[model samples]
Target: DFRPHDEHYVQNFVLVTHGLLMRIFCMCYFRWTVLEFDQVWNPQNCEIWVLEKTKKGRYRLAGSWQEESKSFGPIKFGADKTKLLYPHMKESTPARDMVPGKPGWLDDPALRHLVVAAQFGKGIGVNKELGSLG
Candidate 1:
């Protein structure tokens, strides 16, 4: 069963997905921003982590997620603080055509093919109980 807070987790996952997309496949012009939200029931329970892709083709945690209860920063989580980083668009493409924008092609099922094509196989990390799964 999904908890009441599951929706927040799902939204976080969507943000992570967009971040991965911008980092790997999208052109360098695109910028990504992730803003986490705390559950209303618990003010101190929320977090926002922002990952930015540098010019050198590497992802970096742009800033700390932890902040005072109502502190302001590049990324904020609230009803009024929803302006994440603006995504980049190609020279010929209009700003409205960018991914995650209103009515963009990223929602198409055909994009699933692109995602599968870009996926790397699972890694061979050591398992605590089963030991090496490789």
Candidate 2:
């Protein structure tokens, strides 16, 4: 689980998954929805959705990017510094990754291409399961 709040979020801005190892960054162009924080005591219980548009032009869950993961509120906003919260993200089966042995939906060719190109000297190895990210 990773929650980025600084330059690392800006520079290293791609999700990588190789076998059991998965690193994610929540910075994609998602049609998101927000759930307000109701009570101060229940800070970590709030959630939001990172949505993707379906072929029928409807919104569905892309990933659940948590605003707070471990009791600490990872996202903050507003005038009084209100903590924004979301549920922990889980890998979903996209319509694309439903093919045999593909596993997760983030294994698309275009995204993989970007990951391989961007990860030259970043110490992050490309996926060995499918030969390469691209």
How well does candidate 1 match the true structure in TM-score terms? 0.20
Q: Clash pairs of candidate 1?
A: 36-48, 38-46
For model 1, how does the per-residue alpha-carbon lDDT over 1-134 read when each residue is reduced to its tens digit?
Answer: 44557764332232433433433333333322121112011113234545554566445444325557543344432344443322121121223322532343344432322222212223322222332223
Q: Residue 42 in candidate 1 has what lDDT?
A: 16
Q: How does candidate 2 score on lDDT?
A: 0.33
Q: After best superposition, candidate 2 residue 68: deviation in angstroms?
A: 16
TM-score of 2: 0.21
lDDT of 2 by residue, 51-91 (tens): 45466644443433654563322343222445332332222
